[model samples]
Target: MKLTLERSALLTGLSHVQSVVERRNTIPILSNVLMGADGGRLTLVATDLDIEVSESVDASVDAPGQVTAPAHTLYDIVRKLPDGAQVQLTINDDDRLDIDAGPAHFTLPLLPSGDFPKMTADGFTHDFTLPASELSRLIDKTRFAISTEETRYYLNGIYLHSKDGLLRAVATDGHRLALAEQTLPAGSDGMPGVIIPRKTIAELRKLIDGTNADVSVAVSESKIRFTTGTVVLTSKLIDGTFPDYERVIPRTNTKELVLDNKVFASAVDRVQTISAEKSRSVKLSLTDSNLALSVNNPESGQAREDLPVNYDDEALEIGFNAKYLLDVAGQIEGQDATFMLESASSPALVTDSDDDQALFVLMPLRV
Candidate 1:
């Protein structure tokens, strides 16, 4: 295979695909990127068995052929080449690749293109389109709550469901849950709920962040595909059922408190400084129009802060992880956040005063 591509264009395409390639792999071919040159363009493809990414860039093709080369090494060589310089790539003796720029040249071993695994586009049931900004917002708000526990494999991905004409993404890690919704596209009906793995979501986020175009999504029982412009990504979905999250959200709670989001978040961050290392719990004492946050640790110290709130409920004191509270507060886009509680032992429902599409449920801790 022989091709000539601009230094910046080649580097940009390599940067995107190299991230999908694992740093270490048992199979040697899995560590190299498959390069295909045809139709005056060069396509770079990489995969790690679970996720696959492909990107194409305009290049001057001297011959139509394909080859596999080390992903990271090729990326590093092109990255150090002089800016705007044209790059020449050639495969000689069917086993080595020669790279040449203005004054620098390098040769590297190549693997047969036939050894690269083929990712088939089969059995995709549903297809839809969503704005890049909207998708990014949904991922940014809920990705923090994704569970990392290996035993609970079902909770490691964000659950995407389409019901009642609204699309929702839900994620949780046993201690806190985040649920966000956006209107479904025109033809997104009958789309099955699927759990997208954490790695896939992260890769999709990076791809979306680089462009403003709309992203097309295709889903099936086994895999999920994302395509935008000249880039495409396919990932294997986690084959497990997500927990029924709706049942966990509290439906009825009489006591309520409304506090400024910024003020509440700042207070919790400060009070947590003295919280115990094992259980980062902070106590919230509520009375008529006043709220107090305090944390006492035997090994460390104690901290207390007061804030004015709009609550007239009976006196209540609750304990919660300071980090969890801060995460929920940061999700509140509005100036004020509303918290409904039944008692110190029950879960708290948090929502913004202006938005009803997103909600957070936080489990309280025993101090």
Candidate 2:
């Protein structure tokens, strides 16, 4: 392959596909990016067996062919090259990729592109389009709670489903859960519930421009595809059933405490400094309209702070992971974050005072 690409254009394509390349790979081609140049365009593809990200950019195609090269190394070289420099890439006779830009030159070992695995995406049952910002809201609101434990593979991704004319996403990690809902457009009425893997959620989130562009989505039983402009993401769905997250959402919590979102988050952040490294526990003591936040660690020290809230309910005390509380508070869009508590042992439900589309549930920790 022989082609020349504007530095910005080449960098754009490489940036979109880098996350799909795993840093450690057992297979050779899986670690390299496949580059194809033809018809005045260059396409870059990176895959980690389960997920694949591809981007095509306009370029000067001297000769139409394909080659595979180290994704990160090539990206780093282009990143360091001077601005506006034209990048020339060619496949050498010795099966290496020659990169030349400005005064710097580097050769990366080339692997056969045919060996790169592609996810099978056939028989798409539902196809629809969502505004970029809306899709981003759905993913961002819930991704923080996605389980990182490999033993519970089913909980490692967000559950996406269409219900009651809304597209809902729910993610949970046993300790905390986040649920977000967005209006569903036409043709997405009968979409099946699918578990989008953690890596795909992250890659797709990166593609969202949060602008006027609309993202095209196609969902099949085994795979899901998201395309925005020249970038495409294909991922295999986790073949497992997501737990009934709705059951975990409490409906009978009557106690309410409303406080400034930023104040609560800041207080949590400050008090957690003295929390134990192992538990990271923070105690919440609610009395009348005053809320006290405190953390004690034998090895470290003790931290305490107080903030007046809108609560007038029965005085209650609860314990929670200081970091998890901050994460939930950070997602609140409005000025006030309201928490509905049932008791000291039960989970506390959190929601923005004005935003009804997002909700969070936090299980209390024993201090």
Candidate 3:
């Protein structure tokens, strides 16, 4: 294959696809990106067995052929080239890929394009389009609660499903849960709940960052695909069933405490400085309109901060992991965050005062 494209265009395409290729792989072809030059565009594809990313960039095509080269190396070379430089790629008869830009030249060993694995993308049961801003809100509000424990693979991703005229995204790591909802997009009716893996969520977030275009999504029992602009990302869905998350969301918590989200997060962060490294626990002693945030660590000293909040119910004291509290607080877009509590032991429900579409639940820890 032979093609000439602007360095900036090539670098953008490479950055979109090359991230899917693992740095080290047992299969040599899996470490390389497949480049196909045809129809006045160069198509780049990279995959790591479970996920595949592809994009097409406008190029001056001199020859129609395909080849594979080290994804990261090619990206680095193009990224380091001078601004506005033209990049030329050619596959030599000796099966090497040559990259030329201005006064700089580099060659990468090639693998047969046929050896590159392409994910089977057929058999999508549902397809829909979501505005970029709404998609970002759903992901940003809940991804923090996604689990890292490998044994519970289902919790490692955000659970997406359509319910009660709303498309909801839910994520939980056993200690806390985050839920965000938006109006269900067209063509999403009767869609089965699917767990989107953490890596795919991260990559999709990068793909949609700063763009205002709508994202086209296709979902099936085993796979999901997201298309935005010229880039297409296909990933395998987590096959395990997500737990019944609705049961854990508290409905009977009557005690209400409203505090400024930023102020509360700052207080929690300060008190956590003296908390034990392992537990990182912070206690909340709530009485009427006064709230006390404290941390007692034997290895270190104790810290206590008082904040005036809107609370009129019976006094309640609860303990939570400082990091978890800050995470939930960070997601709140409003000035005030409302926390509904049933008791010191029951999970606390946190909601953003400005947004009714999102909610959070945090389990208390013994302090």
* Best-fitting candidate, scored by lDDT: 3
37-61 per-residue lDDT for model 2 (tens digits): 9999999999988888999999999
The number of clashing residue pairs in each candidate reads 0, 0, 0
What TM-score, to 2 decimals, does candidate 1 have?
0.96
Q: Per the 3 Å backbone cut-off, how many clashing residue pairs does candidate 2 have? A: 0
Cα lDDT, model 3, residue 166: 96
In candidate 3, position 149 carries an lDDT of 98
lDDT of 1 by residue, 258-338 (tens): 999999999999999989877899999999999999998988888999999999989999999998898888888899999
lDDT of 3 by residue, 1-367 (tens): 7889999999999999998888989898999999999999999999988899999999999999999999999999898999999999998878899889989999889988888888999999999999888999999999999999999998999999999999999999999999999999999988999999999999999999999999999999999999999999999999999999999999999999999999999999999999998889999999989999999888899999999999998888899999999999999999999999999899999999999999999999987
- The number of residue pairs in model 1 that clash at the backbone is 0
Model 3 spans with C-alpha error above 4 angstroms: none
Tell how far residue 21 is off in model 2, in angstroms.
Answer: 0.8
Question: Residue 56 of model 1: what lDDT?
Answer: 97
lDDT of each: 0.92, 0.91, 0.95
How many angstroms is residue 333 displaced in model 3 relative to the true structure, after the best TM-score fit?
A: 0.4
